[model samples]
Target: MHVHNSTRQLSLNEELTMSKKLIALCACPMGLAHTFMAAQALEEAAVEAGYEVKIETQGADGIQNRLTAQDIAEATIIIHSVAVTPEDNERFESRDVYEITLQDAIKNAAGIIKEIEEMIASEQQ
Candidate 1:
C-alpha cells in the first residue's frame, strides 16, 4: 500500500500548511501593564485555537521577542494590539494585518482570534 501511504503523508502536509501562523506586536503609550497583559492573552488564545503565534512587546524597556524576517514571511496575519503604533510598523506593510486596541486585547483576546479566523475563512471562499 505504498501509494496509500504517500497520499496520507501528503494530506498531513497540506493540513500543516493550512494552519494559520500569526505574528503580533503589543504596546501601550505608558509601556507598562497593558502591553504585557495583552501579549499574554493573545498567546493563550492563539494556543487554544491551534494556531501558531509569536508576540513582540514594545515597552519602556524596549522590544522583546522581536519578530524576524522568517517570522514575517511565514505568518499568515499580523495583529497589532497597541495604544500607539509600534516602532517598526512598516515591517508588516505587505502583510494582512488586524489592528486592535490594547484594552480590547486584554479584555477579549479570544474574540480577536475568532474574528481573524472568520476573516480568513471568508477570504478563502
Candidate 2:
C-alpha cells in the first residue's frame, strides 16, 4: 500500500510539472474596466484549456499581480492584451508572446488560447 501511494504521488507531481504555464499582461489607456475584464477573461479561458495561468493587470491603481522572474521563466507563452504598452514589457523580450487589443481579449479569449495551443503543437511537430 505504501508503494502504491508513492506511485500515485509521483504521478501527481508529473502531471503538475507537465501542465503548460501561461502568463498574461493586461492594460488599457484608461486602465480601469478593460484591463481587469480582459485579465478575467484570459484566466477563465486558460483554466478551461488546462493551462496554469498568471495575469498581471496594469490598471488605474498601477500594476497588480506582478509577474516574477520565476513565473516568466516557467511560462510557455505570454499574452499581452493592452491598449497602451504595459510597464516592464521588456521582461518578456525573450519569450513567445501573443499580443492583442483589450477588446479582443475580452471578447475572444478562448479563441486566443486555442491559437496559442495550436502554435505550441505545431512547434512540437
Candidate 3:
C-alpha cells in the first residue's frame, strides 16, 4: 500500500511538472449547452489535477478564443468533447489528444485527467 501510494504521488508530481499551460478546444454539434459544459468540466478537472489549462469553445457564435498553434504545441494534451466532428484536430498536430463525449467530459472528468496523465507518462517511457 505504501509503495502504491508513493507511485501515485510520484505520478501526480510528474503530471504537474509536465502539465505546463495545457490548452483544449471544445465543441458540439449544436454548440449550445454541451460545448460550454464540457469546457468548464475540463478546465475544472485540469485545475484540480494541478494543470494550468485554457479552453476554447466553438458555439453558434463561432469559435471563441480559438486556441493558437502555439497553445496546442505547448499543451501536454488535448481533449475533444464534441458530439459531431471536431474542427480543432489540426491545432494539436502530433500532441496527445483524447476524443470523448460531452457527457463523459462532465461525468468522468477525473478519469479524463488520469487518462491524459497516463498518456504523458507513457510517452515519456
Candidate 4:
C-alpha cells in the first residue's frame, strides 16, 4: 500500500511536469489598461490550471518584459488577447496560437485555459 501511494504521487507529479507551459502576449491599441489586465488574468488562470505562463505586454509606452525567443521556443502554446496586432509575431510563428478578446480574457480566463487544455488533449489523441 505504501509503494502504491508513492507510485500514485510520482505519477501526479510527472503529469504536472509534462503539462505545457504557455507564453502569452496581451496588448491593446493604446496598451494601457486592457493589456496589463489581460496579462494578469491569463497568468492567474494558468497558475490555477497548473500550467506555467510567461506573459509579455505591449503597452502604449513600450514592450514590457518582452518575451524572448527562447521563451517562445520553450512554450507549448501562445495566447494573444489584443485589440491590435502583436508586434512580435515572428517568435510565435508555427506555435499553437489562441486569439481571444480582451474582455473574454479578463472575465473568462479559466474557461479559456480549459478550452486550450481540451484542444491540446484532443490534438495529442
TM-score of candidate 1 on Cα atoms, chains taken together: 0.83
lDDT of 4 by residue, 52-122 (tens): 88999999889887999778656666788888988967666555578888998999999988887777678
lDDT of 1 by residue, 19-59 (tens): 57888999998899999999999999988888799999999
| Residue-level lDDT tens digits of model 2 in 58-102 | 999999999998897777667888888778888876666788888
User: In model 3, which runs have C-alpha deviations exceeding 4 angstroms?
Assistant: 1-19
- The C-alpha local distance difference test score for the whole of candidate 3 amounts to 0.72
Would you estimate the TM-scores of all the predictions? 0.83, 0.83, 0.77, 0.82
Local error of candidate 2 at 89, Å?
A: 1.1
Quality of model 4 by C-alpha lDDT: 0.78
Which lDDT tens digits does candidate 3 get at residues 1-125? 00001121235555566546657677887899889988988899889888788888888889898888767655666677777766645555465567777898878887877877776577568
Q: Where does candidate 1 stray beyond 4 Å?
A: 1-18
Candidates 3 and 4 compared by lDDT, better number: 4
Cα TM-score of candidate 4: 0.82
Residue 55 in model 1: shift from native, Å?
0.4
